[model samples]
Target: MKLILKACIILIILSNTAIAQRLYNTSEKLWKPQKDEAFLQEIATTIPTNEPVVSVAETNETCFALMSGNIYALKSGKLNKDNSAPAGVTELKNKNGDIWALTDNGIFRFQNDRWKKIDDKKYVDLCMHAGKLHAATSEEIYRLEGDRFVTTKPENGYYSSNMTMLMEDGTQLHDDPVRLGPISKIESYSGTLYVLRPGKLVLFDGLIVNEDFIDWGLLPSKNTRDMLSFGRRLFISTDRGMGVLQGAALKTIKGEEGLPVENTTCLERGFDQDIWIGTERGAVRMLKDEWHYFGADMWLPDNKVNDIAVGNNVVYIATEGGLGVINFEPFTLQKKADFFERHLEEWGHKRLGFIHTVYQKDGEWVREISDNDGGHTAPYLAAMCYKYAVTGDPEARKEAVESFNAMLFLEKVSPIDGFFARSIWSTTGDKDEMGRHGSGGLPAKWYKTADGKWYWKGDTSSDEVTAHFYSVSLFHDLVAKGKEKEMAKQHLEKIAAYIIDCGYTLHDMDGKPTRWGRWDPEYLLRPYGYVDRGVNGLEALTFMQTAYNLTNNKKFDDSYNQLIKWGYAANTIRQKNVFPPENLAPWDDNLAFESYYTLLRYEENPALRSTYLRSLERTWEVKRMEHISWFNFAYGAITGNDCDLEQSIKHLREWHLEPIEYNFRNSHRDDLFVEPGYTSYEGGLKAISPREKNITRGSRNAVALDGGQNGRRIMEPTGFIRDYWMARYHGFLEAPETNDPELTSVKRRTEQQFGAEPYKGLEKPVFY
Candidate 1:
C-alpha cells in the first residue's frame, strides 16, 4: 500500500509538471504530438460577364472563352475581346500550341495573332490526334496537312447525327433526333478518335472507321453528351450516369458508386487526379472516393455549368451567368485562422467587445443586435482564452479580459442580482428590429439600467447562463491572472449561489423563473420536463461542481452532493436525447458539450466521473460523423482518444472564405443517404462539406442536409476561429512548420499595432 501511494505521488508530480509546461486551462490532461503539414486553401474569384459562355479552353497559360458566337481571350485575369478572330465561331480548341476556332462558315487558325481561315468547309466537331489537327464534317473525317484539313477517308462511311444546340442561356437544348448525317462531337484518346452520332459511338484510327471498339448496348445510356480521356480510360457522360470504356469493357458510375447527380452533361480532366463532371444542375469533382460539389450562388454564377477549363492550380467554370474561377493556394491552418481574425475586423463583426454576424442594408454591412449576443460571444471569449494560453500573446489576453468583462456586465446591468440579461442595447441605436418577446411568447422584459445608458433584455434562458459558466471557467483557468482570477471566482460564486437561492432557477424582474431556466426536481421530475431533465441536470451539476472546485466552498460541495444523491447524476446519462423528433435540436448538443467539458474535467469522484464519461462517449458517438472540430477536440482533450482528427481538419479546411448564407439544396442529390431523423430532423448519413452548406456558427446542425436563404446575411467566422485555437491549445492540431509570411495574422498585427511599413505583397484583400 505504501509503494502504491508512492507511485501515485510520482504520477501526480509528472502530470503537474506536464500541465505547467503546456499551460492548458483545463483540468484534463491530454495532448497530441505536434505534426507538421500544410493544407491547400481554395479561394474563388468570380469574373462576371454579360453574355453566356458556351465553351472555354486553356493553353499556353492563356484561357479563351467562346461567348455568344464571339471569342474572348483571358489576359492578366480579365477577359478581352479578340478582335482579330473571325465571327460565327461555335467551338474553340488548342492543338500543338495553335488556337483553332471552328466557325459557322469555315475553320480558322490563329497565326501571328490573326485568325486565318484554313478550311472553307463547315465541320461539326474537331480534335487533335497523333500530333495532327482532325476535323469531322457531315460525311468525312479530315486531318491537318500543312495548315490544310485533308480527308482521312475510311473504309466505312462516317456515322453522323444532327448537332445539339445550346440555348442563349448556355443550357443544352436537346432536340428530337432527326439523324441528319452530322457528327455531333468528336474526341481522341490513345491513338483512336471517337465520333458521336445520334445514339452510337464510332471509332476512327486514321484509316479505318468502325463501331466495334465500344458496344453502345452495354453502356449506361445511348445518348452521350461529351467524352473525356481520364488516365487510361474514356469517360462518357450520359443522362443515366457516367460510362467508362476501358479496352472494350464498359462500366457505369451511378448513385451506387457515389455519383451525386444522375444527368451528366459534360466531362473534363481535372488538375489533380480528380475528374470534373458537369450536370444540368451543377459541377461535381470526383477526387478519388470523395465527391466535392460546387453549386449555388456562393460557388458559381449559375448552377447550369456549360464547360470547364483547367489551368495550373485554377479552374475556370463557364456558366449561364458568367465565369467562376476557383483558385487553389497553399495555406496552413494558421494562415486560415489569421484570415478569419482579419475578417472579423474588416467586416465590422465586432461591436462593444461582442462579436456579431452581419446583414446587408442599403448596400452596407450592418451589425446585427441578435437576441443571443451574450451567448454568441461566448465562443469568441473562449477562443481568446485558448489563443492566449497557446501563444502567450498580450493582445489575446486583453481581448479575453474585455470580453469577460462584457459578459459579467450582462448580469450587472440587470435589475435583479445574479439575473443576467439576454442582451443589452442602447435606446438610441440603429432602427433595426429588436425582438420584444422570447421564443416561448413571454412578454419582453426590458428594463433601464441605473445609469440610463442601456436597456437590458430579461427572461434569459439557460443557454446564456450555460455560455457564461463555460467561458468564464476557461477564462479563469487559462487566461485570468492574479486579481482577475479572483474576480472570476466571485462571479461564478454569485451566479451559483443565486441559482441555489432560487431553488435552481434563474428568475426575471417578475420574480418568476424563466420558462427554460428551471432545473429543480419540481420541474425536471415531471413528465413534461423529461426532455430537458438530462441536459439541465448536467448543467446544474456542472455549475455547482465548477464553483466548488474554484472556490473550495463547502456550501457548493454540499449542494453538489445532494444533487448527485437526488439521481441527477443518473439523469445525465441520457443528456444527449436521440429520440422523439420534436425534441431534436442542434443547440441542445452545444449546451450539453459545454457542460460536459467543465463537469468532466473538474469532477474528481471516480464513480461519478465514470458515469459522466459514459454520457460523453454516448453523446460524442452520435456527433462524431459531423466532423465538427470543437466536438472532436473537446472529446479528444477529455478522453485522450482518436477523435476523428483528420476529418476534423478536413472540415476546418473546407470552410468558405466568404460566410454568406447562400441557399444549398442537397435533398435531390442521388448520392445522398438520408438517415432516420434520430439526432436532427433532417439528419443524413454523412455531413456535407461546409463549403457546400449554409454558413454555420457551430450550433447549427451539421447533419442538416439542406438549408439557407438569400445571400444577404453573413455569419461571423468565430465558429471557425474558436475551434481552431482550441485545437491548437489542446495540441489536437499543431502549428505548421512553414507558413505564408504575407497571410499570417501576425503580419496584420505588426502593421496595425507597431507602425511597421506595409509590404506590398502582404497587403490584405478587402472581404466585403
Candidate 2:
C-alpha cells in the first residue's frame, strides 16, 4: 500500500539525516487562563428620541425623561409618551417613591399614573435631606412640613465677619463677607445639605444654613458643571478636570490620571460601587482605580452628554442626539472565540477554507477577495492548531485540517512546482471586482489553471511565504496525524526545496524572482536589499530548519548550513531595522517574529540558536512598549521569560466587541508622550488600548496616533483568536479562577440567533 512505502521513505530520510526532531509538548497541561473563561461584556445600545432630551430620572419601576416640554417613560428600551405628566415640565425626579416633576405652572407628583400638584411655587432644584424634601428657589431654600413649604433660615451664631478661602495646603487668601448669590442646586452628603450657588457653597445642618462654608481656591475652574458624592469623596466636574474633595484634601483627575478628555459635562453615582462621569466627547466610568471610556459614535449617538442615570446593571446617558444605554452582561474570552468562529461561517468569511474579511456591498455583507488570503488566514489556522492541542477537541482538528489543505492548495493549484499563489479566484463565481494589482501597484500575474476552472495569482511575496511556513509548521507539530502529518511534511519540503533549486528565490514562469521573494546572497548582499537582508535571511533559514525538522531531509539541512556559511547568521544579529525611519514598519516585526519562532524552535545548532535568541531579545524590547499581543505571546512562548503578560492581557481584554473599523482620532489627547524622534515614527511612547481606538492586527501599526477605515471594512477576529489560544497553549496565561455558566453559553445562543441564513454565492469545493 502507499502508506507502507511512505513510512519506508520517512525512515530512510530520518536515518540519512540523523536530525532529532524537537517538537512542542502539546499534551502538557502547564497552566490555565489559556482557555477562555466567562467575564462581563459591555454592550452599548442607542435609544433615539424624537426631541433633544434634557434630564433623566430613574424610578423603582422605570426611567423617565423630560423632552420638549413633555415627559416620557423608558420601558423595554423604548420611550413612550406619558400623557398623565403635567405640561410645561422642566425637570423630573424620583422623590420618596413618587415621580416629581418641576413644571412652569407648579410642582407636581405622579401617583398611580395621575399628576397632583404638590406645591404652587416653582423651584430651581430639589433634593431629599434627612428624610425631608428640600426645594431651592432663586433666593431662598424651603423644606416640606406636612405638605407645606417652610423657609429655613441661617444660624445666627455661625456667621463670620470674613470668609476664609484656604488652599488644600492650608494657605489662607483674603476673602469678603458671607454673600450667597443664589441657590442653583442642592445635594445631600454626609448628613449635611450642601447647596450650590454661583461661586459659593452653603452648608445646612438640619436647623439652618452655614453660609460661611464656601469652596473656591481648591476648585480647578470656577465654572463647574455637575457635583456628585461617592464613597467619602465629593467630585466636582469642571471644564479642566474633576476636582475631588476628600476630607479637605484636594486632588484632580485630568489627562495625567487617565481621564480621556478634560472637559467633563455631568456626573452620577453608578448602580454598583462606581461613578459615571460624562464628558464632551464620551462617557467614563470610574470603578475602584480603573477608568472605562465609551466614546461617541461607537457608544453614543452624540458626544455632548446632558445627563446620566443608573438602572441596575445599565447606565443610560442622555446625549444631545438621544439616550445611550450601556448594558453589562457576563461573557468570557472563550465565548468571544466561539462568536468569531461562528462569525466566519455566518458572515460568509470562509470560502473554500480560505478566510476573507467582509465589507458591505449594496447593504449586504460581501467577501473581499484580498491578496493576502494565505497570510491573513495564517492566524486562524494556528489558532485551531493551538486550540486542538490544548483542548484535544476533534472539532478544532477538523477545522485546522481544512484550513491547512486550503493553504496547501495555493501551491497545488499553481503552475510551477513549490510555488504558491497569494490567493485564488473561481471563474464560476462573479467577476473579480478586486482586480489584478498588488498593494504596491505591481502587475499581479493571474494564471489560469490547466482545467480552466480557477485563476491562481502568481508573484507571491515574502509575506505569504512567511505566514505559510509559520502556520503549516504549527499544524505539523500540533494537529496533524498519520497521512495528514506526512502531507504537512511534504508541503514544507517541496517549498523549501524549490527555493534552494531556484537559487534562493521564488521564480515564476518568466524565471525571474518575484518582488520581495528573493533571499539569495547575491540579492541580499546588494545595496537595494541591504535593509531587508536581516529579516529575509532569517526567513530563509526558518524554511530550511522547519523542513529538515519535520521531514528529516538531508538536503534542507545541507541548504540550511549553506545559508549560515554566507554570513546570514551574522545579518540576523540586529534583525529588526531601526536606521531609516521610513523602513521602521510594524509588518516587518510580524514577519521576523514568525520566522524567529520557527527557526529558534527547531534549530539545534547552538551557535544559530544563540544568535537568534539575541535578535529576538532585542526585537521584543523595542516592541514591548506597543503591547502587541501576538509579539508578546510569541516572545513569552519562545523565551519562557516575563513578556509583560499583564499588559498583553489587558490589550486583549480591551479589544472592541464591535469589530467594525471605525475612524478614531487620538492626536489631540493630552496624555500622549511621543518617543525620541529617531524611533517615534508617529507612534506614542505608550500604546493606547484598543478599546479607545480601532481594531489592529500584527501586520498593522498598533501605536499609530490616528488612522482607521472609517467603517468601510470589518476586521477579522482571527488575530485575536490566534493570540488568545496561543497564550492558552503555552502557559503564559492560566484558566480563570471563576467561570460563569451563563457567560459560557453565549456562543451557543449566538449560533442559534444568526446561524440560520445560508451563505450566499456559489459553494466552492470543501477542502475538508
Best by TM-score: 1
What local lDDT does model 1 show for residue 379? Answer: 92
What are the per-residue Cα lDDT tens digits for candidate 1 across 84-190? 78888987776566777888789988766677999899987777777777788876778889978778763343332222343457433334422323577777877
Q: Model 2 clash pairs?
A: 32-734, 32-735, 33-734, 33-735, 34-728, 39-331
lDDT of 2 by residue, 1-768 (tens): 999977866664443222112343223322233444455567778787657778887777578887887888888888988997788888777667777888766888777767889888888777788899888776667888976889775542223323354456843333433433377677787777776665445665643346545443466776777777676877878888888866556577788777777889888888779899888877888888767777766777777788888878888888888888888776667666676676666656677777777776666556677888899889899999887776666688889998998898888888677998988887766333545697479988888878877777888889999999999988987878788888888888888899999999998878899988899988998999988899999999899889998888899989989999998988998878876667786788999999987887787767777899898988888777777789988887676677777777877777767667766766666556532322443344547667777666568566675776766677787888898777767767665555565554343334442311333444444433
Cα-based lDDT at residue 435, candidate 2: 53
Candidate 1 lDDT score relative to the true structure: 0.77
Best by lDDT: 1
Specify the poorest-scoring 10-residue window by lDDT in model 2: 16-25
Q: Provide the overall lDDT of each model, using Cα atoms, as 2-decimal numbers.
A: 0.77, 0.76
